[model samples]
Target: MRFKIIFPTGYQVADILNDNIDINVVLENGDVFFGTLFTISNLDYLLAISQEPFFYASDLLIVKDLSKKNIRAAIESLVSGSIELAFTKIRSTWSNESGSDSFDTIIDMC
Candidate 1:
């Protein structure tokens, strides 16, 4: 089974599994960086979006909403400058690990 996952903006990251998905990140500083992804929960992700040396869940511009609790925890972890904690909180809620993972991948190859 294949389905489309689209962000609020037109930007889309295809094949978001552990497989490196090609996506462009526009940082808060207006600098655009291009790369394939690891786990989006990785610290590299926080670094990509944040202009600050210390990163947070609030630092994330794109969010994967699972539950209100998950979103709140993600922000709180960032507010505390714990990117790993933020990752842990958000990682649990990522849809890929849930029902989505059971399906065959669907993606646009950039």
Candidate 2:
């Protein structure tokens, strides 16, 4: 099943997903971070740990239609360590912006 993850006003694409929940983050700028969901909060917070660093409460996207399949896929990806591989394949396919790279970067990174 397909699920739509929505971001709050100030939330970034990288902020979503926890280290315990197997998930792949697909950024608008084509940057993918693979990890598991370590914590999920009702206040639109998700804490995840990846190979690089630990994600905090402020770094998460709110998923509107959280579905079982989506969650399952995320878990599977995390367990298999395929999140990075999947991201590499999808990142390049993401369209690039023409405007201010810094602004775009900031927006996407948020």
Cα lDDT tens digits, model 1, 35-55, are 322345545655767888875
What local lDDT does model 2 show for residue 67?
48
Tens-place lDDT per residue, model 2, 11-107, is 3234334323334444444444443333344332322324435544322333322344455554344435644433223333333245432323333
Model 1 misplaced regions, further than 4 Å: 1-18, 39-110
TM-score per candidate, chains pooled: 0.22, 0.22
lDDT of all predictions:
0.34, 0.36
How many Å off is the CA of 64 in candidate 1?
14
Of candidate 2, the 10-residue stretch with the lowest lDDT total is 1-10
Q: Clash pairs of candidate 1?
A: 56-78, 57-78
Candidate 1 vs. truth: CA RMSD? 15.0
